[model samples]
Target chain A: MDILVFALCLAIGIAAGYRNWLPPYLTSRSSWGLTAAVYLLLFLIGCELGSYRSVLEQMSGLGVQAAALCLGGLLGSALLCRIVGGGGGV
Target chain B: MFDPKPILVLLAGVILGAMGHLPEGFDDLIGPLLRGALILLFLAIGFDMGKEPRLWETLRSLSGRALMMPVAALLGSVAGGILTGITVGLPVGLAASASAGCGYYSITMILLKEAAGIEAATIGFVANLAREVLTILAMPLFVRYFGKAGALGAAGATAMDTALPFIIRSAGKEVAVHAFVSGVILSLIIPLSVPLIYRLLS
Candidate 1:
């Protein structure tokens, strides 16, 4: 269901863009709609996290473990991809 | 591209919520409002990708090596989690599944809730959100040192939407396409793989 809803929105938008369905004013980046949408999502995500009081409380106790997991995963990804990917840089 | 403005806005929202400033019954509204906003964001991102003048030309040029990006990302995350989980004395399954969320917090939490319980779900939520924030903040360094796949792999599902600005800024528009592709692939697969691995390991 999560994938379905996400893909449906993306497909609709792609079709609209491909077919020039949205008005130029909206489709153009000048409207800053995209920026607004992104910022809104980020803000909402923060709100969602903050609303979960237990999660917030647990953060203090479990944060070190979480950070360790994050770093390990990140480093493993970088190392493996670096070895195999030839460091395809910008 | 490394805009601190969005991060600041996020922190402001967090402070407001933490302070209970959102008024009574706002909690119920947050989920729906966030969904609406996310839909809009996804649409905008898709439209931008679709309207790129060289979209097809770029897609056509994708190499076999580029296709391997998500694989490396998936395995690397699992390997890292297993090792870290052992070092930390946590369940390997628990840590691996959480890290495999690939920064997609909402879905990862849901998956953990079903597969494990609320406690495990909470851990998954935090771990994955950290991955997202870290990717947003440090994508440039990941790209500079570890290469495009390093950043994209670390970004996981966010390589498409949440992490795109950083990836594009650090790696360029061409590699951003690869980021989008790998992100889409990981997004699709993570939902499936996370659960299976958890069930197997547990």
Candidate 2:
């Protein structure tokens, strides 16, 4: 059931892409759509965080380990880019 | 005017969480919302792809760079997983799964829930979500310093849909196309790769 829903959503996205409906939003001089989307997502994130307040506290209690994982992910990605010579124009 | 979808879905999640909803029911709603969000995001990416006139030229110019992006991403995933496992003392597989999870936060969360239970899934989801935020904030610096290939590696599969407009804005149409193709390829691998990594490490 979940897979079916995922496939359906992906199909819709592909359809939208092939049909060319996103450029106007991207190139719009006014930031209406973009701002709305960003803000909405941000608010959603905030709400989720708020709901997970206890979990956040618990995770933070885990201390340096959690922080290390986050930093490691970032540094690892950056290092990989440098090593692979990915630091050039596409 | 504010777009309602993100807000609505978020509100729904919050309300449910506040109400102390169980994982099974929340899972049902989250699946649909995530799928809906991805569809909308992907559609926008497709539209952006349509506007690129320099796609062919860019592809021609960066063929070599394009090939390197995924290799970089794969390396990043492995390195991240290893480092995290060492630091957190979690199983290397779980760490690796988290590292390779990309920006598919909801999907990763869903997978973690099914495989490891709700608590583990939530942690993975938050970590993945943080990764997305970091990707959005840091993408420009990467593009400036490393160029399109760097940015593509940094963005991973997110380059296709969520990050498509930014790539278009930062590097132009050709780069965006390259990123989009790379993103699609990465997304295909993530679902299988994350699970495999977890299984192997465990």
Candidate 3:
């Protein structure tokens, strides 16, 4: 559902841009706008994390398991990149 | 390409939030505000992509390598998750399901709840949440050392949203589109994979 909404917004934005529906000024300053939006997005993510106090407690209690899984996934990804990443690094 | 500025903002937010300083009614605002900001961000990304005259040409050239990255990531995540689960004494099947969430907490948690029950769902939540936090903190370094694919792999399903900006900043605009495509594919696959894995395990 979230992905669908985001995709819909992206498609609408592209169409709007292509057809000149959005004002030129807004389009011109979009890079800055995008950056600001990113800031807000991360802030909200942090807030969500903070609100979930039980999650934090769980994290602390199960720190080793969580860290192990996270690191293992990342390591697996890196290893896979070595095997399947045909093109050189960007 | 990586900037310290945005990360500082993220850290500040975390600090303030941890300190219990979010304003009254702020909790209510988070969901809508996040969705709204996401729309605006995607709109900006789409507009930017549309304006690039050579975008199609680049995507064509990059598609093969780009397409392979996410498949690799998914495989790696499952392997890693199962490995962790075994080390931690969790059933391998349950661990694989949790890892299948691939850093997409909400979708993974809900799916695990329905398919594997609340315990698996909780593990999924923690594991996927850990992935997101790790991606946010380490993406630039991943790009710097391991290249664009590593960053995308770490981002999992979040390459489309919370991690998109950092991916762009770290890997550049060229990789950003690939990240979006990879993220989309992973997001689509996750909904099915979580349940399928659970069922298979059961």
Top-TM-score structure, candidate number: 1
Per-model chain B TM-scores are: 0.71, 0.69, 0.68
Model 2: residues with Cα > 4 Å off, grouped in runs: A1-59, A62-68, B1-11, B21-68
Instruction: Evaluate candidate 1 and give its CAPRI docking class based on DockQ.
Output: acceptable
Q: What is the TM-score of each candidate against the true structure?
A: 0.65, 0.61, 0.59
Candidate No. with top DockQ: 1
Root mean square deviation (Cα) for candidate 1:
5.7
Error of 1 at A71 (Å): 1.8
lDDT of 3 at B27: 76
Q: List candidate 3 stretches off by more than 4 Å.
A: A1-63, B1-62
**Two-chain DockQ for each candidate model:** 0.42, 0.24, 0.37
lDDT preference between candidates 1 and 3, better one: 1
lDDT of 2: 0.58
lDDT per prediction? Answer: 0.74, 0.58, 0.70
Model 1 spans > 4 angstroms off? A86-90, B82-202
- Per-residue lDDT of model 2, residues A1-90, tens digit only: 243444454455445445555555445522354334434443344344445657556666434443444556655665676567545565
